[model samples]
Target: MPDNVLENVGEEYEFEFVDVQSTPVVINSLGSDSADVGLLAYSSLANAIQNEMIPGGQSVIAPLTYDGPRYADTYNSTSGSSITDINGLDGNTLGVNGVGSAIDIAARVVLTRNDIDLDNVEFREVSFGAMPSTLSEGRVDVGTFIQPFFEMNSDDLQTVFDTTDAFGSFLKIFVTARDDFIDENDDAIRAFLGDLWTGIEWWKDDDNSETRLDIAEEVVELPRDLLEALVQTDRGYYHGEDGLAIDPEWLQKPIDGMAEVGFLDEEIDMSEYVDNSYLPEEANTEPTIE
Candidate 1:
């Protein structure tokens, strides 16, 4: 997940989802350029906040520490490795969606953890839609993209490194909406959470394995094999319970690190940036379906 996604709806709730993409016109039809709530890759939303696209978005729960393949996502979600760690990334180029973009920052942040200087790592800004393709062509050393890009094309590409490597679970896929949305349509937001949780619940049920795979392939549009791998028992996606559960330690570490690296302003308080009351009392708290 890219950074912009914010949570904190409630400690009671857990996890995050990638906001389904629709045509720009469809997004515009929401009646306001300001989406009361929008699910985004954690980094995307994080970048949005940095640019003031939305105010006060915080990650509620980080279900899975996010990871991007080192190369194009043609195949191999868990196959090849990227840079094999930051030390390998000491002096190299990173391809990103754009200049000074979230992907660039995420890559830099991961590298910075190894005491790598941003000035030393060259950045190549390409269009978001074209990044994966660009990486596959060997035009760039590394690229940061969410699921479909890496999932669909990891056939030959590799994941050099992720936020989790240097920062310890710093990666996260998240759900976020503008602060106004949280203040205004509490019910709508709640409903959104319910449906989202239901969707994930259905996705993890063993008896419903067929259905789950179907949705992942058709609904979520995930690569068939990768979707299956994610649904396997005791691995991928679901944790003790809430697939969306935010690891407090994981969440805060990145926040603290980002600020330490000058990615965020110290003036911003985490509380004002997020809220967690919206989560229901019993999230998928147990790994067992019981």
Candidate 2:
């Protein structure tokens, strides 16, 4: 999402952007009432729900994006050699951003889906920025990094598989709010969501490529050409021209898969945790993209 996407919402509503470390921290901030609304990875949200970290919190919207191949690139060391597939990870150490994070859970799902023995592999915690360097120095056999990293270091890295390869059409990120906040600020919430929808639509339009690239260049500090290439690649924001929407069935699948993989102790109650009513009418419908 853009840094100031909500700027156009209007004078009546004000939005605050809090930069945090991880999804768990985002959930904790929400639960502690330190944050009014926050976005979190689907798995982390599930973790919060399962552990009752955020009581009466509801997922207001899930910004679904689906470019095939996704951002989950598992790679070998600097040589970009030695690993060919999931089985290649056996008996090797895999570096992830965090142990119990969304990426960690995604790595588990991908590895287990290939029938790789989880016990045979060691998951080491590595920072996102350091993942490439760590893998290059032989500190870890395999490591995962998100966009621009893979694009930036393709020569030094070799892809085993992306998360989409293991679990197709997964929920990427979701927005959550405390029930009290939603109850008292319904109109403000609607206005915020409607403006958010406008931004998503603006972002997904092919005609806005240059404008988007300019913004990307300023924010990510990358070359405009590289950002342009990423935009061309089937980057799945999973949203459609219609608007952003939360699909119960879509949301349930990943939680169920995570639970099945032992990342989550139990299944989550979707009805209790999701409040689609806060979504703008245009965004409350089924997802327009397949």
Candidate 3:
């Protein structure tokens, strides 16, 4: 996440990225223990959605996904390889950075979608950065992943499918803030939300263009050229095939799936959790995040 989300909300309030990609459940479990909002990959967020674990009785925004014009470093979509089919992973241990991380939920989503019983498989939590090795070492059949890690490991593994294959599209890295926060500072909330789009735009096709690489370097400590490949490779932010607009339908399906899997304790309506009022009503139709 950009510093703006944390540092520029207003005079006093602030927020920042938590790197919840590692042990997301730990972070989610810590809700209100530390910060008011949580940043989760669409897949990891699936667990919360599945379990109805959001702060209020609603769902968080689903992150966007897209087919890049360039090559993605992720595994093969239809190719016959280690994960030739979903069943290929049956009984095979799966790798995730953390138990509650998005990769875990996303991988589970794929397995459940394929009717694979998760009880029969094991989810080995490792560093998201090290998942590729877990697979190469023959420790797991496939690795659950996000950008860079997903791309970085493409050399050794083949994706049975990606966000589209698993969930019809990539899940959103949603912002889950308290209802009180939204209600108390509607204007600040709107400003923060607008900055989110603008920040994403800077990451995505910005003319300055180093934002994505810089993110990789800052977050992953990768070299500039290496970071560029990590971002520019067939990975990075969404501009989904259909377009970049947020898709509620895309979110609903996965949330329903999470509920079916016993991740959620009760049935909750999406309407209760989401309030799109912060997004410019007219700007919701834009193709990219900004």
Best by TM-score: 2
- Worst lDDT window (10 residues) for model 1? 68-77
Of 1 and 2, the candidate ahead on lDDT is 2
- What CA root-mean-square deviation does each model show from the true structure? 7.8, 2.8, 4.9
Off by over 4 Å in 1: 1-34, 41-85, 99-102, 127-133, 148-155, 220-223, 230-249, 284-290
**Model 2 lDDT per residue over 1-290, tens place:** 43465554546487778899887888888998888788877778887777778867556454644333334434445554778687888999999888777667777887888788999999999988888888888888888877777777877776776766655665667777877788888788777877777777678777887888788888889887778767645532344446556666656666777887887766776655666676667667765534
Name the regions of candidate 3 deviating beyond 4 angstroms: 1-30, 41-83, 98-101, 112-119, 211-216, 232-234, 239-245, 286-290
Candidate 3, lDDT over the whole model = 0.55
> How much RMSD separates candidate 1 from the native structure?
7.8
On lDDT, the leading prediction is 2
Candidate 2: which pairs clash?
Answer: 64-237, 64-238, 65-236, 65-237, 65-238, 66-236, 66-238, 67-236
* Per-residue alpha-carbon lDDT of candidate 1 for residues 53-143, written as tens digits (9 for 90 to 100): 4434333422433432221111111235456556665677677665534345556666676788888877777765687667667676666
How do the predictions measure up, each by TM-score? 0.66, 0.88, 0.72
Q: Which ten residues in a row have the lowest lDDT in candidate 3?
A: 70-79
Local distance difference test scores for all models: 0.50, 0.71, 0.55
